[model samples]
Target: MVAFGFTVANAVAAWFAHYDPVNIGWRLMFAFAAVPALVQLVGFLFLPETPRYLINHGREKEAQEVLHRLYDNDKEWIAYEMGEVAREMRREAILRQESGDEFVLRRVLRTAHVRKALALGCALQMFQQLAGINTILYYTSSIIRSAGVHDKITTIWISCGISTVQAVGTILPLNLIERLGRRTLVLSSLIGVVITLCMMGGAFILINYDSSKINPAQAYIGIDMNSTNTNKELLDLCFGFRNCDECVTSEYCGYCSLKEESSSLPTTFGQCLPVNSENIQHSLYGYCKDSMNNATAYSFTDTSCKTRFTALPIVIMILYISVYSLGMGPIPWVFNAEVYPIWARGTCVALSTFTNWTFNLLMSLTYLSLSQAITKHGAFFLYAGISFIGFIIFYFFVPETRGRRIEEIERLFMSEKEITPERNQRHEKTVSASVI
Candidate 1:
């Protein structure tokens, strides 16, 4: 439900961005988030304190009252639950006393089960980021633009579609987790992610290659290539054209003119003038040099290059987000919380969360730079490779904790051979019998 709400917010923001004239639509979207935050604050004020917290703080009468209210005045269940909570609190106190003032981090590091849990937790978080979901989430507009979507409104709408698919995908795991199990869901999700990322990368590669073929001439004082002669000699002449040393001849040469008085005038192509005139040196194309200052020098002729794969990239992006939302998006945190013992669970989960945020920050900050360093296609290919590696790691090292108690999970991780087929069969039988 929370993920659904978040996607709805993204859709609304995209809608705002589509129609915003001054480009401040994204800012307005962020500003609107305060509405939900304020509502949550007011809601929290009216919520009653939990019975367990009251019991732990020595407010026994309040704890009993809250328990009775929670159980709808069912004295039997309330008494049983209160005893259980008190016993758990006593056990926790004993564990703390045994640690004898040792730092929680140090104690966590010393315990084998806790240490392994922390390692797996951190690795899961890191792998989640390496899957490259943030790349799409943070730069959806730029990515769609690169894929040949020129209209801002179209790009934003496409992004909203991707977010909607992601939200819908999350629903599957809610019902499937207990039946299909964590390991299967995560592995399947990663496989889907790898395949979708490869397809997206391939689509971009085709678009970029076609774009290059259409516009071979570099952005020199932009000259329209379609209007120029196609002969090799003429092409070579245009390529070799240089800034004039002086404004001595009647021949036209690229030169910069003063800033145009009107806002609509083109800036790249200025009026042609002789070499070294007061005009700025702009380009060497004769036509550009001869044209008026406001003339459009060279509008990109390769607008059609992306048309072939325009829908392809968007489809791939939606598929990738859909696959990710299935299990990889939420299961890692679930596993992180469940794997640790109660005494160290909080610290371990905090460290895992820190790892997630750190990697998320790294990916968001470096995505643009990496895309420029290695073309967009290469970046996605690299991410796909990382996801493949993550899948292998999870398959071999991560254990399924479905239907298992924390103590059982700890034991499974502690013993090297505990995940063998024989042990799994025995564990399943035990769980079945317990349920019966």
Candidate 2:
């Protein structure tokens, strides 16, 4: 709520800040962010550890206290609930004993369903990172600049606003998620994302192809991969691309002159064919200057712009945030949590988390390289295509598991050859009776 509120407020502010306050935009952004961090600190002070955590460590008395605090004057009800929970725990322990399934990696890897779940979990994590969310998040200012917002203040404000919207977007589904099935939500979100991305790409293409109403110096330019100057490459790495051609000067006007022309005894008494135009060197005795200076003309432009990102880009940006939050924002974490059988839940969660980090590393490491090699639009387009592919894969192969029990969901992935009606019946009986 805070983040979304901030976004909406900032958007209003941007549309009506009176003066173009692009000068101190970044500092203003940090100031706003600090307010939330301070608020979060205050919130933490009032929050207590959950009863589940207390009970997980067998601190029944503390759990009881928590339940009492939560329910108030319902000590007997709390005690009854705790007893039932304890009985369920004991039943689960007995099941684990009977089934001989240890909550360990070795045991999890031996199960075919668990293995399939792991694959899906890993794949989801990989998809989320490869979508370039973190790269955009971390370098939002640069991304905005590349999109043509040149003024530091404008870029910072836009970045903070976008981030605030993304954070705000998280709450939308949080409120509506239970009402909608997971698969439907994910698919719907992806479709929105596909549209937003295509729009964003169109915006870039429009900016690129349009050649009216702007100074040449203010327009975006292509990076010349065949640039000869090493200095240009280094600068491009730091601040997108700069045309070295822009640095050339008129001083290098077509020629270099040799030193001491005709000064050696006046070129042997001014012989040597008097004055050959192409083969002549002229030198004077006192303070002589070369006829031409070494200079060239270079034309270049920075990719950033303050005036270009008007209302249209802002709308497209918000759409991007909405779509992102709807699907890519939450699914990875949810899938990571749900894709494992209970016995291997911990291991699966860890593996899925590792998969997320691994893909994050890949995206982080490759993002700049890809951007430098293939321009911003191409990079984002590539990500959109990959996301589309992932959407399709999820639509077909991924099971719908909105409100299903984790164990029941696991059976859906079990080896068909090993799972018969008798086996399923026994499995259901074991699960219901709290057999492992």
Candidate 3:
């Protein structure tokens, strides 16, 4: 639901950006997020405390009242539920007394079962960020622009669309978590993420390489090929020959206005070379210096140079977002909560949550710089490689928590000597009666 709310907010922002009535529309969109917090605050005022929490705090009378109200005055069920909660609380208190005043973190680290759980919890959170979903979310607009989408409104809408797809994809795992199991969904999601990232990287590579090759002659003229002192004179001649009004420099090749005006001078400087030119046949554009001192312009013929592969990156991104939302989005939270014993559950999950946000911040902060340093395609390819390594680690070390009791899960990490038969039998009975 949090993810859904964020996606909807972004969609609203995109809609406003498209029609920005007074130029403050984007600000309004950001402000829309605060509405949910206000709503939650109001709703929380009327919310009742859970029966177990009341019981745990020694408010048995209030707990009973709350449970009676919750179960529609079913006295038998409330009694049974209260007994279970009381027994669990007593067991936890006994365990705490036996363990003495040791720090929760120290205990967690010292215990074999909990240490394993902590490792898995931390690792899952780390992999979630390292997989680069946040990178895609934070930089979707920039990525759309890099994919050759030139329209500002179109890029904003496409980003909103991707978020919408992710929100919808999250529903699949909610339904499949019990049926398909965590291991299946997680493994499948990783595979899908790897494939889509590779495809996205390949698409960018193709487009960038093709665009780079379109006009090699104009690109080379001022830099390497025409190394005479007349380089400045040649650059001036190229600039003079350009008809700014008729030439669109933003396109793949700057069309020569002079060629259209008269067929006599068939060739012009910094323009796209002919399709049959030796350099053009070799897919190499000559380099020329533009008015901007450091900028290089490649020569190209006036043919339509845009590739049909322009839409491929967006398509691959949508696939990647959808796959990530399916399992990676929600399973880590569930696993983190379920892996630890009641005494350490809150502390362990908090530590894991902190790890999650820390890595999330790191990823968001470094993504743009990393992309600029290694290229966007390379960054995604790097994420794919990390995801592959993560998949292997998870398969070997992470247990399937579905259909298992918390005690059973903890015991999975313990040896036979560590788990006595009497305790196991007691846990089985507790598991049969207790609510997760």
lDDT of 3 by residue, 63-103 (tens): 98888778999989998888888777776766677579999
TM-score, candidate 3, is 0.75
Each prediction's number of clashing residue pairs = 7, 16, 22
Which scores higher on TM-score, 2 or 3?
3
In angstroms, the error of model 2 at 180 is 3.9
**Ranking by TM-score, best first?**
1, 3, 2
lDDT of 1 by residue, 348-434 (tens): 999999999999999999887787567678889999999999999999988999999876887766756445678567546544433
Give per-residue lDDT, candidate 2, residue 69: 84
User: Cα lDDT for residue 415, model 2?
Assistant: 73
**Which segments of candidate 2 are over 4 A away from where they belong?**
1-59, 98-103, 211-313
lDDT of 1 at 397: 85
* Reference-based lDDT, each prediction: 0.70, 0.60, 0.70
The 10 consecutive residues of candidate 1 with the worst lDDT sum are 241-250
Candidate 3: how large is its RMSD? 8.7
TM-score of candidate 2 to 2 decimals: 0.67
> After best superposition, candidate 2 residue 405: deviation in angstroms?
3.3
Candidate 1 ranges beyond 4 A from true positions = 65-77, 212-305, 416-436
